[model samples]
Target: MKSESKSQHVGKVTHHELKQTLGTWQLWGIAVGLVISGEYFGWSYGWASAGTLGFVITAVFIAAMYTTFIFSFTELTTSIPHAGGPFAYARHAFGPTGGYLAGAATLVEFVFAPPAIALAIGAYLHVQFPGLEPKHAAMGAYLVFMALNIVGVQIAAAFELCVTLLAIFELLVFMGVVSPGFQWSNFTKGGWSGADTFSMGSFHGMFAAIPFAIWFFLAIEGVAMAAEEAKNPKRSIPIAYVAGILTLVVLAIGVMVFAGAAGDWTKLSNINDPLPQAMKFIVGEHSGWMHMLVWLGLFGLVASFHGIILGYSRQIFALARAGYLPEWLSKVHPRFKTPHRAIIAGGVVGIAAIYSDELIQFGGQTLTANIVTMSVFGAIVMYIISMLSLFKLRRSDPNMERPFRAPLFPFFPAFALVAAVICLATMVYFNFLVAIVFAIFLALGYVYFLLTRHQRETAPTDALLEE
Candidate 1:
């Protein structure tokens, strides 16, 4: 933990491993999951009765808005796709304070998401095996993933490759059932009755759905966190970014269309594992045993959780090395060559979330879910800021080397910025209260940085000042 000379890599930044371990395919597997449609569980806001058009509008808006945001991230990530992701980018573009807020939000978001995914795994497992206790299922899944992450990235990547394949297979199987039983009338009429309409009673309900829908599409940028591990970052990073989004877009459309046509879309509303339930109705238990579908879906959950923990730990490592947080957190296990401190820290947060769910009577699931939602909004805010940073950096350092340039330059980034703003505007529309929560989170991070200014003396921060 000793400080290095300013001329040295004081951030404890070391290219300690070969980049060949991560290629375009591995990176995409780690970032995108075929079953992330679980995110849309709560998407049924009071708009469904507005008919098929409303569903399509929500679906297309999410897809387009998210793609634009990912494009903006592609530029930042390719430039400095080191471990910290946004934390690193914000530091370079806007200095320490900006870095701290973005890093803090990213850390909280990552830490919370892993357990949430674990819980999701439990939900699916319970649906699949009615005898399994929900809490036990959750803890068992968490324990399994905890080990998977600690075993080292090589093992994690291999596990990712396997589960990703399973995910794709399961998606195709579900698609097969849905395609043949497809009833276009189910989608065209009465499919959206349960959602909130634009009326006064359900205005907030409708507003809340925007952030939830947007949340499903926000984490694709996480693939860039592995830039330091990518075989050829300049080529692999952009491919991973764009490719991940494309995969998600196709999967999302498939799920939405099938879900709409196969069942009363109203029933699918607000349920976490709507696909399996919909599948049961579409193909009946005989086509695929209900047990098999449920377990397969749980496997997808585990795959996503594993990837999430890996991506998030690197963000923590980047923040630690840059001196915004404790230096020990920057350390990598010498043998495993992974961010050990960040991994453990992420585990603790995951455990805390489990306890919070157990101890709170005020609907911990709902609250935790909302907190995660707020985290998603926090990401949107940072994205909007980051997109602006892209324009500013291009103007300020036009001469800087960019190994992978964003296509169409300012136009694409500008379009992304506008989409990000629309996301924020939607957040404000849906729940000003959640917007306030994100604002408070940002303010607290800034204040904590002020209180921690003394730690800067011996802390490594060269990365913050890097060109």
Candidate 2:
């Protein structure tokens, strides 16, 4: 009893306050910037598993899931408005175990995603400077962006807004430059897993491509993680989330369809730098337009990589503050007011993953593809738990002050839940080894939680919920 009291005292002393500086536009920037990198690179990997048409079909299905999920999820984000995002909701709904599950999954998603983006950043850089190793460029990205995030949220968000806008502009330019080259035949040729029509193999490929389809909007929900930093979270969060998702859905489909239609789609299917490569088919490798893509494309990758560093740091800090991680990690920077230790800690893990690209491979997949799959596994798990939390909260805390209620109550959340479950099942079936690795990661975190359960202080959610 004495030790427990001491532990509680230790928790009470840890600083967890964050500056409430973000507004609606900044929040929207973070929401979109957190995922703009998807339009730049990662989604093309889906075209490898599912053919162009199959991947398009897969993308559409996943977009529907995100549309529903974001609308439903906004209610929870605004209601809770905690830095822990899904973790806060799950904890309130299903207690500590649920919180741990959601937190661990969110950590995995945010952490693993950057290394993949880092690699794509490297690949894009390699196009400009033939002598630079992609991995080295990836490492440099980790260092640069992590430091930017450590500086401060206002500075970081402003940079994110700038880069995100630039990335969007570049993508529009890419579409226009490639439009004249687009042909229906180029997009449809071998569109169904190399088959003329959809078959059982096409179905399997489509299911297998779920992870990459998810990549297009993987971190959009991360805006919720910034809610506590928003000036008026209740109003800003809904506007940010709703506008962000719509913007991404339009950009994602346009980029994918345009890039695919601009070339022999299969050639772009298996590459990290698909857009620039597709542009080369029309504009030639030395064309100013192709060079512009290679340079400005960095903005998209930078936006996501930098924004996610902001995100994962908050998760780490929130988890640490709640006693789910080491207490020292919860420390806030005195001057910057940023979670300095948490930022560095997550950066260490990401750098290690970036270096492990060659050493870690499962089923002949590139580290980028494998990590993408792993990240998606965590994302799907979190989505399921969050939706369940929404349902649980409505029943258990019916009187809870909800700023925004999910439209089509139960149906929207229900669809998001079911879609997430299906995506998880299909992803696990296709990428069983990566699934095992992801499960092991969660299991390890859970074991630590169990061992330290007695020492944990009251979670901050209790206080937030009371308010």
Candidate 3:
């Protein structure tokens, strides 16, 4: 039998280890899976309520910032090339405290997102069965993916690829129906609300939109989490980041335009599941087919939850490997070679969110806003911290070699950071209950940070598995 290496895989006493390395395509699929959640259902609602110009401008900024941010992360991921990408990078550059903060914030961002995606799935399901219980739908959705994950990592990765393909097909179909209705006049009729929060003047509206926009663009960095699994981390990971961002950007622009032209921007604005409503208005009685389209797109979106759970599971595994989290969390299955414990942890969170919402009647209560805002707000905090880390790393570790550098150096990261802050301000300005909930999460992370600080310091070297 092959002897196990002396390197500790974090605190847990385990003979298991990570299985096969992921290739470029799989890495890209992970990134796509993360951001694709928003494209299918979230974006339309966020942008539609604003006028045509509001939607278009928001789309433009989202596309631009995301493209630039992908490039920035490409550099960071390449420099670190670890499983827990940002956390690993932050730790290496800024030490354990910074790493913990980044990891904690990211954990909150990713963990919170599954619920948002699951809830969206529940919403889409409600279209077919108007009285469908969200809790049951969410639980069902979570259970299906959790089972797929328990099957093994390869299945989870392959599933993500399938989800991406299906999402592409769904978007193309949506574009086909709505693209023809595109009218330049629609875009010229309205302007952004210009609400204030971050920036100095009239652009406050744009600034305020920043946080939610960041939320929408949050998952594009999934390449980092699966970096260790990549067949060739240096090549495939970068390509995936770039390709996924480009594809999402183009698709987002198309979707925004399509959603705008399908009907009056005014009417589509308030509907959370806007595509179905827009299609209903456009195709009249044939809206059933449109509903079918939404249902199909929703399937792809839900499939993404499987990929997300997989990505985050590995992150927790990495965290454990680094001795920041419990060693048991970092354990890979001896046979399946997947991080079973981390997967379970993530699954628990996903199901719990589903179950809690069911019990509290979250959709029927004021807490619905709390649930939605929590994810958005968490993402905003993570994005801001990640960007800030970038600046700090540049200053502190000027000598660190960057295989893939952020284009325009300080300028792009600076701008992206500003954009992220602006988005958070917008959420607050809009009085989104989600923002308040996000503050609560941040406070929670802070508390967790303080609690974990001493433990991290005293963490034994044996707890860190170098391999």
Candidate 4:
């Protein structure tokens, strides 16, 4: 392996590689933390669109998609082990244009996700202190986490581990606390999109709920973005991804079900602080349990918020190193050996999005809901391209060493690919205006890529392959 400081030049682009400092546990922490915030909030919006029963059906379908997607995506991550994640796979499979589409979609997914998490952090804080503006708290979270990420991957990942553990524990406590109050009647009331039985309306609601259902495991794929930073990616990534997905599936279903049954399901839907608000139904507004939930809930939001800052910075650094973005953003900090410029650059974009909550609205959705849908738009696109890349590589590079092949081969990847296509279509149908906004973002990014074509350097296929 080359030194972290080694730079390879191609055309006008130079790559500044990230250090390999992460282990299996740190990778697991990151995999879970990156998506834990969805459990904290953002997902309850599904209840609003699909009703509790309808959303459960939506969530089950999406979970199956992610389960297959992660298993297949791990193959590409272990084979390439590049910080570019899907970009490297797509580039190797279909050349520079494929890389650009995958990279742009990934950037949108990672960059937009943090602002929504930050806002949720603010909302959690606002519950404790009513006078604090959610946007102010959201902006403050970005600054604090960005600094932590800029310091180093090890420290950032360690913090993510601690917070993720706490968040997981708190969620368990929540289920136990509310379990006594749970009733079959409350859960079934207005369950099928406010109808007595399933109908076309119920199906439409389920389709509309796709994005929120997706929130359950939105950025687990981000574990791949840290492939270059892992001590032994082929071995560690598989363990982390497999364990992370199982843990999340159990937690997502438990949290959603228990929260719904604790009280009137409708009240828990469409709110940023659903857990605490649901707890208030059982423990009362002034109870100690309610206070604990309000405080500990921040850990869940923080885990995802901090971990994603780590995810987006690595992505920005990779994109810049490959000349898809400005070269200056690729510079690693000399002392910390981290992508400081990329961390701060992503922070700027997220902070701007935090301020835009009031300025942007689509289909009468809340800022968090709209942003979640937009991020899912990027995610579904990346998933489709990534699965295609997996198939392409299998056919094009028959002899490539694969330490961890996706189980069930074509069956697993094909299932994931088909599900991702269905999700993208459903999301676009329900979120047409937000889809336009997402398309505009991609169009602008593609235009930038075209203008800088002469400066771009595609990383070699064998550059980061492990021995």
- RMSD in Å for all candidates: 3.8, 2.6, 5.2, 3.5
Q: All candidates' TM-scores?
A: 0.88, 0.95, 0.85, 0.94
For model 3, residues 317-383, the per-residue Cα lDDT tens digits are 8777655677678777776778888888887886787667444344233334445556566556666
Write candidate 1's Cα lDDT for 138-212 as tens digits. 777767776776667777887887887787677767777777778887766543333333344343343445665
In model 2, where is the ten-residue run with the lowest total lDDT? 1-10
Model 3 segments more than 4 A misplaced: 1-16, 47-49, 130-132, 191-208, 287-291, 357-368, 398-401, 428-467
Predicted structure 2: clash tally: 0
Clashing pairs in 2: none
lDDT of 4 at 77: 94
lDDT of 4 by residue, 1-467 (tens): 12111233323333476789999999999999999988988789888878999999999999999999999999999989988899878877877678889999998899999998888778767867899998999999998999998888899999999999999999999999999999978888999997657888999899888888899999999999899899999899999999999999999999999999999989988777789888888989999988888788889989998988888898898888776788788889998989999999999998998788566565898787777778889999999999999999999898998999999999999999999999999888888999999999989988897788644634322354212
Lowest-lDDT window of 10 residues in candidate 1? Answer: 1-10
- In model 3, the Cα lDDT at residue 419 comes to 71
Candidate 4 whole-model C-alpha lDDT, 0 to 1:
0.87
Model 1, runs deviating above 4 Å: 1-20, 34-52, 128-132, 191-207, 286-289, 358-365, 461-465
